[model samples]
Target: MAKIAYILLCHKGPEAIIGQAEMLTAAGDYIAIHFDGRAKPEDFQQIKAALADNPNVTFARKRIKCGWGEWSLVQATLLAVEAAVQAFPRATHFYMLSGDCAAIKSARYAHDFLDAEDVDYIESFDYFDSDWIKTGMKEERLIYRHFFNERKHKWLFDTSFHLQQRFGLKRDIPHDIQVQIGSQWWCLRRRTVEWILDFTRKRRDVMRFFRTTWIPDETFFQTVVRHLVPDSEIRTRTLTFLMFTEYGMPQTFYNDHYDLLLGQDFLFARKISPEAIELKQRLGALYSNDKAEFKISNEGTSLFKFLTGRGRIGRRFASRFWETESTLGRQRELMIVICKKWHVAKRLLEQIRQVTNVPAIEYLFNEEHTDLPDLGGIQTSLGKRTRHRRALMRMLFDYYETDQMIVCMDPSALDLLQDFASDRSTTRMLEVQCVFSDEYLIGHAMRVGLAGEQTSAETLERLLPTIRGDMTFESDKIRDAEFEHHYIINEARDAEENAAPLSNFLDISHDKARQIAQSDHLFAD
Candidate 1:
């Protein structure tokens, strides 16, 4: 029989904490809990009373008020660790976990597995040499001192951090020790835990150095393990399986993830939502199935590994864009609607959407209308279109498989538009009704025999020459835009005639486009 002491740090969710305490004690293990000082007193009383019958459970001597990116979290964890060791003298190993973590397998399997291992299961990496820190302060986290809490006082934290950098306020770490960083979760042998606790008590210099360091909980224990423990006993991985988003935030799992969680190789998973009632209930029923001898695999992923390796892998996501990208799921759909004036373009978009009865998302690259409509299923970062237009389309197509999306752009962006129509695309060349020819708006004034006497004739007199010269001047530019088939809008022909050579293109009107959207003739291949 192997005894493992569990040190749990909890901030919220009292009922969940009591249930966890009961489960661990039932598994023949000892547990110590450190409740956050900021929690309500009534909540603490409820948790304490619920676990009163368990003799294997203990509480921290003192509670600490914890905040994000502060050293108070490390202090709370240390208190729980000490209480667990004192209460369970026969425990051979120590495991640190957050309140949200739950065992996917039996607790007996966890203790039996750890009891069989000689090496400690903790992730350790050289801080300076490793690319563990991705977004925020890397070397500066250790070089300069941070006083204000980053979450509570963001402005003050940034101001002080910058002022220290501007004046070269630097701190020197002891020359004998090397700084190491890793995940906050670990499962360590009792001998290793005792060594770490003893050193922190004796070395006041190391404690002071880590107190002001950013997120010291990640560094303090990891640094101690490397500086004090033998190299052969350290295994550079954690027992927890976790994942993070591209923005470095943890991905939360819900009841829908029950199958995914059970298929995982690790025994424990952190950051499960407290509101996931079905997940908690189903997983709780399986807690007593703790079989010995390799019931679960030791290989597991950590947050530190996920963050550093994010940008390197090929992404496979947001596949809902496929139906909108092409007429059918198989073809790539795109069209180049070249109308010089935006007023003509807007009316043309309305006609297509009304006739086809299909959702049409327009104004992607037009400068005047970058604020896209609230179109669902379109999950893209709009900022990328401004800085890297070509890269944005490539990334967009990677997530959204599309062959039939109607794309409207100014002639200037046509250079980057070619990539959207690849070898397997079924593209369309669309020409809309000319702005001046339309009878409703600007062209109306001139159409009703008021051009000669109108005071605005001066502006229109100068504009007619450019309108006459515009399409003919842009004939070569239009043909090279990589359009699959050119379709002339069968309204009254105007200067748009010069933009498209009549002999080489197909003729399509409102009726033709509507027909194409309903049936799949143009993309049969």
Candidate 2:
């Protein structure tokens, strides 16, 4: 059995710690607890009692009080890691956690999973030039000065450039990863832990460098880890959805909503209110079909309860997300109908006139186009109106061929276009509505007096930079991947470009972008 140690850090984490402990217990790994030094004595007593029975549990004596954006948080973590390594020397892996975090998968499985990949397991860090102010970060000059003063570090400029490279990445990737700073909580191989702790211990300058920033905790460890293991698949982020309500932030504990606990992929998350917790649990269960458990711990709590509860919940939820067939049974129905009016256009335009035919020229124009007809069905016309339609048809037919044009017409016109294109060329012009495209938004805005005609075009020109800005946030390696994902010119490129012209959409304002970045609604799952 591979030994592992789980580290929990918190100011005053609630029952969720119990669930985490249970998770680790079921995984059969040892766990250690580190409470922020500022926690009340009574709270510490309660915590110690909760964890007392677990043989693997060891509560830290050295506690450091941490506040958001303070360096103390990172110090607390590093302290715990030092303790854990000494206490569980045989452990193969280390997963750091917060009191509010819950395990969505078996804690033991994480150690087992280490065998599948050779990643270093640091969360991704990307640049954020535009949202720098939004996230409450200091300007470049201040950040640079602070680090230089704190450690006299020479590499601040290089790190800044590295971050810039990530922000401007342009690629056509379909994955759900965004570059940002690393999270405090993470899972690292024991080898990595040993190396980082050693490096920081010998380099007091590096420690001082980390102490200068608002949340230097994220970057300090990330920077050091990246240096130590440059080529590892540092994920930099997980697929957890976070939400902060309009009122006070949510509470961290609850008992009835066990199903919510199982739906998460991460072992834990920031706190949620009791009301929000209920909703999150219920909604998660309804949509994802996962179950969750809640627990609490202090000094007395054992790691066993955390691991065991998590393992039980994870097994059930894993079967739902991974093993079971989907319960939502409906799928899209595509209807294909073959109609014959193949030769109608050719026959009407006859250079080889047949005597039995009707007045082909007049029939082309006299016919009422209640609905747009299929390309194969429309009679060839020489009148001005028919000529214009033909011009549009030629543009479309080049790509689709006569029989292939899938023009989406309301009920009546579908057959006409289909029939008309059947004979002339194999290419068919597909009919589609432009409602969702920027063109519709622009024109509708103008019609409703919300914008002038040029307003939409001007808005688009302005919005391009912001879109370009947001696209810049990427890790150094991921920036390269982004370039590859977005700019690839293929058959789909022409279709996508022609479909939505930015000239019709508003340039997203800075205010709007900040709102999007900060609003829980924007980030909500």
Most accurate candidate by lDDT: 1
Q: Which whole-number lDDT from 0 to 100 does residue 340 have in model 1?
A: 52
Candidate 2 lDDT tens digits, 1-525? 456687788654445465456556544677878777755566777777887787777766588855445577778888888888888877777777665554444444444456666665666465343232333334342233232211112245346534644674222211322223555566777888999988887877656545755456666676677667655456665423233211112323344434444444444444433234554444333322223232432211133244334544774322311122211111111111111121222222231112111111212323454222233332233343343444333322221211122222222333333334332333222111111234544443565475664665678656545433332332122223222111111122333342232111112233432332232221111
Error of 1 at 132 (Å): 1.0
Q: Highest TM-score: which candidate?
A: 1
Regions more than 4 Å wrong, model 1: 291-525
Q: Give the TM-score of candidate 1.
A: 0.59
Instruction: Give the C-alpha miss distance for residue 439 in model 2, angstroms.
Output: 66
Error of 1 at 84 (Å): 0.8
In the predicted model 1, the residue pairs found to clash are 325-402, 325-403, 325-404, 326-403, 326-404, 332-403, 333-403, 333-404
lDDT of 2: 0.44
Total clashing residue pairs per candidate? Answer: 8, 90
